[model samples]
Target: MKIKIVENEQQLQDAYTVRCEVFVEEQGVPEELEIDDLENEAIHFAGYDDEKPVAASRMRLVDGYGKMERICILKDYRGKSYGKELLLFMEQVAKEKGIDKSKLNAQTQAEAFYQKLGYTTISGEFMDAGIPHITMTKNL
Candidate 1:
């Protein structure tokens, strides 16, 4: 898997296409919520498997932490390590930006996945976009 910062409109669209497939179509999250106003401020990332986008995420430096948001992978790619690679790539970018911490509101179902990546639950379960979630954090 090759992950790259979304640098052009087409790349950004590719990222959004994957996000829409996973978040909006499969997860029942609203389209508006999936692509929020924070997009202009966040640095977006997309992972491709031989020119086809398989994963996507965005990050913003928020209060000294890299705030990871809208992370998702296509159904066919879920079990692969591409998700991990995408996250590690994002963390590397965060580190290069002088951020030492990472934070995300992870869907409860994915909490274990994040935990395996060294993220610790920081808050109790809560609702976001009508779905259950918990805030998780990790050191970069």
Candidate 2:
């Protein structure tokens, strides 16, 4: 899979399409909440397999940490390591920006997946978009 930095309108829309599929339609996240106001401030990413969007995520510098947001892979594309690949690409992007740490509020169901990549749970479970999540962080 190739990772794309969303630098244009079409690419951004592609990212949104992936997010809407996995987070909104499939997981029941409200469309309004999934695509929030922070969209303009973050660096968006879209993972493609021969031009088909499979995964998407974004990262922003928040309080000196690279905050990962909206990470998701399409249902048909899950369990093939594309999520891990997308995350590692985001981490690399953070490193390039001189960030030394990364943070994310991962859905509880995906907590162990992030753990395998070295994120440590830093908060008790909480709800976001009506789904259970826990804050996790990693030192880059």
Best by lDDT: 2
Evaluate candidate 2 by giving its C-alpha RMSD to the native, one decimal. 0.6
Per residue, candidate 2 scores C-alpha lDDT tens digits across 29-91 of 999999999999999999998989888999999999999999999988898999899999999
Q: Candidate 2 local accuracy as lDDT? A: 0.94
lDDT of 1 by residue, 83-132 (tens): 78888999999999999999999999999999999999999999998999
Off by over 4 Å in 1: none
**TM-score for every candidate vs. truth?**
0.98, 0.98
Task: Evaluate all candidate structures by whole-model CA lDDT and list the values in order.
Answer: 0.94, 0.94
Global CA lDDT of candidate 1, please?
A: 0.94
Error of 2 at 94 (Å): 0.5
